[model samples]
Target: MHLYDGHFGGMHLIWWIIWVILLAWIFFIPADIPYQKTIKDSPLDILKKRYAKGEISKEDYEESKRILNSDN
Candidate 1:
């Protein structure tokens, strides 16, 4: 049995394939860049959230709602 008969060709091919896959993985990975924008809630949506969290009284909520609706 000649151990070196096909070792060079087979191992060289496998190493090349593994190196290509490693390079692709390094370049294609996901990143959260600093310039990426975050979604912002609207004024009315913020008001609704505050009311739901008990930060505003019902009277205040209704008053604010009326004012906001009138503005539109």
Candidate 2:
């Protein structure tokens, strides 16, 4: 047995730093890029989102939905 029987040593601090950097990369990488669009939203998806956000009424939504569905 050596001296200094404590919990955290040099490697523990390094691991903590690695974990913090990994978490930061996971959380912020996608949002950090302003112009990089990962998922391309379709016209139907846009219409759905607009309807969900109250930008279009139900009647108009149904009419546009029918038009969009018939084209495909």
Runs off by more than 4 Å, candidate 1: 1-32
Cα lDDT of model 2 by residue, 1-72, tens digit: 644566447778899999999999989786646777578899999999999999999999999999999999
Q: What is the lDDT of residue 3 in candidate 2?
A: 45
Best of the candidates, TM-score: 2
State the C-alpha lDDT per candidate: 0.90, 0.90
For model 2, name the residue pairs that clash: none
Could you tell me which residue pairs clash in candidate 1? none
> What is the C-alpha RMSD, rounded to one decimal, of candidate 2?
5.6
Give the CA lDDT, 0 to 100, for residue 5 in model 2: 67
How well does candidate 2 match the true structure in TM-score terms?
Answer: 0.52
Summarize candidate 1's per-residue lDDT along 1-72 as a digit string, tens digits. Answer: 788788676898899999999998878977677989978997889999999999999999999999999999
RMSD per candidate (Å) reads: 6.0, 5.6
Clash count, one per candidate: 0, 0
| Total backbone clashes of candidate 2, pairs 3 or more residues apart or in separate chains | 0
Q: How many angstroms is residue 26 displaced in model 2 relative to the true structure, after the best TM-score fit?
A: 10
